[model samples]
Target: MSEVPEVRPPTVTPVRVVIALCLIAPFVAMLWVGSYARTGPEFIGIPFFYWYQMAWVLISTALTMTAYQLWQRDQRARAARKDGASK
Candidate 1:
């Protein structure tokens, strides 16, 4: 009897795409906002450029947190699959 090769399950490509977008969107938004703010006036009292960069700092933090959470979830799922396969 010939033995067939084992096939690995397909990866969650969509979820990975979503995670990448979530991580990249904020950075892209920040860049757009920065370029616009460079030519614009101060918002209320703060300088336009300064405020724009500061806003991005906060946004980047949020994006980083989201990425971390997604990575953790992915890791957990992978671990669970590994554990199941080992059983």
Candidate 2:
């Protein structure tokens, strides 16, 4: 009889935690409406509420890109490790 090896679930790593934060930050910021639902602090005639949301658009794009890059790097590292272990 051949016994099959057990497959363990992947553990949480710091890289993954950082990646999650990068992805979640924008969502958390925008969803917490009370934090930026004000009209003061105008920027060049634009209300703070308007500019803040617009700024988050760019910030979200950067964060999303960063998360994607980190994910790609993590995947490549994982693949290398898997190949090395199989050999």
lDDT of 1 by residue, 1-87 (tens): 996565454676666777888789777877685475563587888877788787878887887788788878887887888777766
Span of ten consecutive residues with least summed lDDT in model 1: 4-13
The global C-alpha lDDT for each of the candidates, from Candidate 1 onward, is: 0.75, 0.90
Residue range with the least summed lDDT across 10 consecutive positions in model 2 = 3-12
Superpose all Cα atoms of candidate 2 onto the true structure and report the RMSD in Å to 1 decimal. 2.3
In terms of TM-score, how similar is model 2 to the real structure?
0.88
Per-model clash counts, in order, read 0, 0
List the pairs of residues colliding in candidate 1: none
Q: Which stretches of candidate 1 lie over 4 Å from their true place?
A: 1-9, 33-35, 38-41
Give candidate 2 regions above 4 Å deviation. 1-9
